[model samples]
Target: MTEHLTIVDHPLVQHKLTHMREKTTSTAGFRRLLREISNLLAYEVTRELPVTTREIETPMNTMQAPVLDGKKLVLVSILRAGNGLLDGVLELIPSARVGFVGLYRDEETLQPVQYYFKVPQELEDRLVIAVDPMLATGNSSVAAIDLLKKAGATNIRFMCLLAAPEGVARMKEAHPDVPIVTASLDERLNEDGYIVPGLGDAGDRMFGTK
Candidate 1:
């Protein structure tokens, strides 16, 4: 887990995250906060992106400055709740290509079944970031990554709003190469599989559902 986990501790991220955690936050408020926090998280996540020096002229001088190198980034949202994070990340990188993975758990078997998935044309050539609000059992997260890998994504990173210890360990064991950026690593999941002290189901809160 040492190599896989990178917890963001920026004050703005933490402050917005705190508002996202409050139970009284309305659907509109939750959506807005998630978007704001996601932008902050996206900033940290893309901080180390490869940059190439290019000549640029300022009002007073011409100098070489860094610019993003290689192909445009690809953002793969892990459905419903992932869209919430996606919205904010897009605000920062509006030109990034977008993809979607739709997975739903079968209550009886407790397994993830993919219903939809679409990725960019050349996945292997681009940096891919998979977004999801909660890393719960890690089943769906792992499954989503499997799909992306099958589609030729070699460089991948996982971004989430909140995560649990079990899920973090599971993701590390399943996909050690994919680093995870999260707001907070909370206590263990409750019996019902929700992260203890978590804000609640991100999809429900974001959409005024449930």
Candidate 2:
């Protein structure tokens, strides 16, 4: 966990995160907050993106300006809930290629089973960011990353709105190289494997469903 987890605790992030956690938050409010928070998280997660210098002329002068270097980025959203975070991150990095992975729990084994997978071409050459709203059991998160790696994604990162200790540990053990960015890491998961004190099912909250 030490090597892989990167908790983003900036003041703006924390402030908005608190709002999203409130029980009284409306669907519209929750969605808006998630978008804002995701943008804040993206800023921190992409801090080290490679930059190259290019000649540019301003109104008064010509000078070398910094631009994103090399390949365009890819954003792989773990379907359903992950789409919430994806909306905000996309707002910030509109040029990034989009991908989707859908995993649902098998009732018998309670393990994640992938139902859909799609990613950008040349994933090996681009920086990839996998977004999800919650890291509860970690099964889906780990499985999603495994799929991404198999598709040739090398430089990868995970972003979530909230996470539990168990999930973080599991992810670190499975993929030590990929760093995780999240707004809050809660105390633990409950008996049913949901993050304690979490704001309920993110997909439900975002979609105004029970």
Q: TM-scores of all models?
A: 0.96, 0.96
Q: What is the lDDT of residue 132 in candidate 1?
A: 98
Model 2, runs deviating above 4 Å: 1-3
lDDT of 2 by residue, 114-204 (tens): 9999898999999999999999889999999999999999999999999999999899889989899899999898877778898888988
Candidate 1 local accuracy as lDDT?
0.92
> lDDT values of the candidates?
0.92, 0.91
List the lowest-lDDT window of 10 residues for candidate 2: 1-10
Candidate 1 lDDT over 1-210, as tens digits, reads 235888999999888889989999889999999999999999878978988999999999999998999999999999889999999999999999999999986766657899999889899999999999999888899999999999999999999999999899989899999999999999988877789888899999999999
Residue pairs in collision within model 1 = none
Best by lDDT: 1
What's the CA RMSD of model 2 in angstroms? 1.6
